[model samples]
Target: MEMEKYFRVDKLPHIWCPGCGHGSVMMSIVKGIDKMGWDPEKVTVVSGIGCSSRAPGYMNFNTLHTVHGRPIAFATGIKLANPELHVIVITGDGDGAAIGGNHLIHACRRNIGINVVLFNNQIYGMTSGQYSPMTPEGSMATTSPYGNIEPPFDLCELTRSAGANFVARGTVYHLPKLDSYIEKAFGKEGFSYVEAISQCPTYYGRRNKMKTPLEMLEWQKKNSIDIKKARDLDSEQLKGKIITGIFAERDDEEYTARYDQLIKSVQGGKE
Candidate 1:
């Protein structure tokens, strides 16, 4: 765990609000990359505008901070233009599941070689506590004073159904499990998605009466059940519970590899 090697030391002290779980989730990403032994020079991190998108600013690697909800698109292009590069996308609930949602689905359908780590704070924390696509029904937010009537998207299940080669979910409170999911996602040959459930104490907590970050973290611990144990429970028993674990993983033809084969066929092996 020589973290300095993977972080921009000059960027010491991030700007995330106190009690935010994003920092932990961001560290898990770095740990995954380090454990995989991937050369930083060959890795590229892309992000869209949001609290989570700031990760690339501290990461010591080829990085791109893109427009809101479009990091996946930018990452896909980078991967296609030079298939040798390992691309990772850091996006948030509002940035990924709302505006950039279509891009997320298509990337999964294409099964591209990119790792998408979504930091789901359940609210648009960067945008001043607005409700996001991942905000739970009946949740309070700047945009949902009367409680959010819309159901939240189960991002892991969405990606799994959309053809992602690997899909998983974990909470910031469960750091080791989160890190393991990310590491596994990085090792997949095709499109992989990991939803890191993060706490937004300043915005989400203050609005929902959680009072403190510790309370939010405790809520996650009490509500989350491993995917293995979840199977033994009925739907009623699982209600309001966060199921954390890998949902899908399969050996499939990756987008870049398939594109390369098509190019070879079209040019008789000449680039």
Candidate 2:
């Protein structure tokens, strides 16, 4: 496929640091969207304040770069107004799981028709280097000079448990499969989520001793375990491994459709 069709050429030269995994992940998203053959004008991209949020600006779509941690709320409104639109949210670990955690949970619980692609780099890259909700325990950051003491949130597990119709996990290293997951999410009728494990070489890497982006990617390649492979291994064998794969899929009536039905019933067929 000619990649130019999927991007806004004027937005070339993205601001993400060199060797950062965000570029590959963004490409995978566009590839997935292209495969789905959704009309560009009908696709809406929403995002909160973060590095990942910058993606919507680079894409040729109806994009909304919203306030910190509130993209889902705004997206909910958009979906309510026009259920036909394909709404996708681009968020970071800090933006989605910290300040916006409440909204994320409610979005999953409501099973709204929106695809959330969480770019989890494990730290607040946009703000220099603060520890985020997905930062692994004992990882170093500017906020956690010694090591991060808080436990990380497993996004897929959380979303699946919260009733999202579909949830999947993938790393930038597994980009082709990541594209597949995004495509699957976009096709689902209810709330869907894909957590794209990204690498932040500029901030997270420098603070965490991953001197170069390649080193961080190498570590990811070595530590990540496919969910299928993980099931075969005992807990002891899987210690400290990153599990990547589809974690859940359910067919639920989307919130917008159900709400419309309720309104019709309440109005007794009146306008």
Candidate 3:
């Protein structure tokens, strides 16, 4: 199937700012979809309010551009209504981890069969640069003129703890590896979470003096460690480190699977 057939060019010249890593993420998703050989009609992409949210509009599939911080809820509904469709949620740091945090946690806890691609640019790119929940401590943002006073949430750890069946972390610079992770997530049967550490060159880059998107990419490359190596690092050595790769995975009953079992048991009791 021709990949271009799945794109909506009217939304052309995507809304993402120049040098934004969100573009890389968009490409990775497209590539993953193609590699999976998924039928576009059988797939649905949902997003909330953010640069990442605009992604669903550009894709030629069943799409939902929902309210801010609610893509997970929408995705959940769509998946429950038609469990056979491959549902993917595109969300940003603020939209997913901050305001939408409750939904994110519940989705993971339910082990719903949905693939969530979380774009973690650290700062809120669409809201004129406020510090997001994943923004590192001491990082400058519009809200943090001096620097952020609080520590950031480790997204991978949060999702894993919430009981997501699959959890992984990757950056735009690691596109090849990220594509593989995304494919794995799509193939997984239960809640699959990917925190894609991306760059917001316009806001996050300028404020932090990362200056350009390339510089931010370089930072990610330098700071990120393979999961295996990260596990071996002592606390002191692991400071300021970003671990990339699949952190946790397990094969367990998905939400629908458990539901089916309950129905069967109830039917047997009735008989």
- Candidate 1: count the clashes: 0
lDDT of 1 by residue, 89-205 (tens): 999999999999999999999999999999999999887999999998889999999999998888888999999999999998999999999999999999999999999999999
- Candidate 1 Cα lDDT to native: 0.94
lDDT of each residue in 1-271, candidate 3, tens digit only: 4646788877788888888999889888888888889999998999999888888888999999999999999998888878889999999999999889999999999999999999999988987899988898889999999999998888899999999999999999988999999999988999999989999989998998899989999999999999998888897787667889998799877987777678889899564
TM-scores, all models, native as reference: 0.97, 0.96, 0.96
User: Per-prediction count of colliding residue pairs?
Assistant: 0, 0, 0
Residue pairs with backbone overlap in model 1? none
Using TM-score as the measure, the top candidate is: 1
Across 56-143, the per-residue lDDT of candidate 2 in tens digits comes to 8898889999999999999999999999999999999999999999999999999999999999899899889899989988899988
Model 2: C-alpha RMSD to truth? 1.4
Roughly what TM-score does model 3 have, to 2 decimal places? Answer: 0.96
TM-score of 2: 0.96
Estimate the lDDT of model 3.
0.90
Whole-model Cα lDDT per candidate? 0.94, 0.90, 0.90
**True-vs-predicted CA distance for residue 155, candidate 1, Å:** 1.1
- Sliding window of 10 residues with minimal summed lDDT for model 3: 1-10
Taking every candidate in turn, the Cα RMSD to the unseen true structure, in Å, is: 1.2, 1.4, 1.6
Clashing pairs in 3: none
Rate residue 3 of model 3 by lDDT. 46
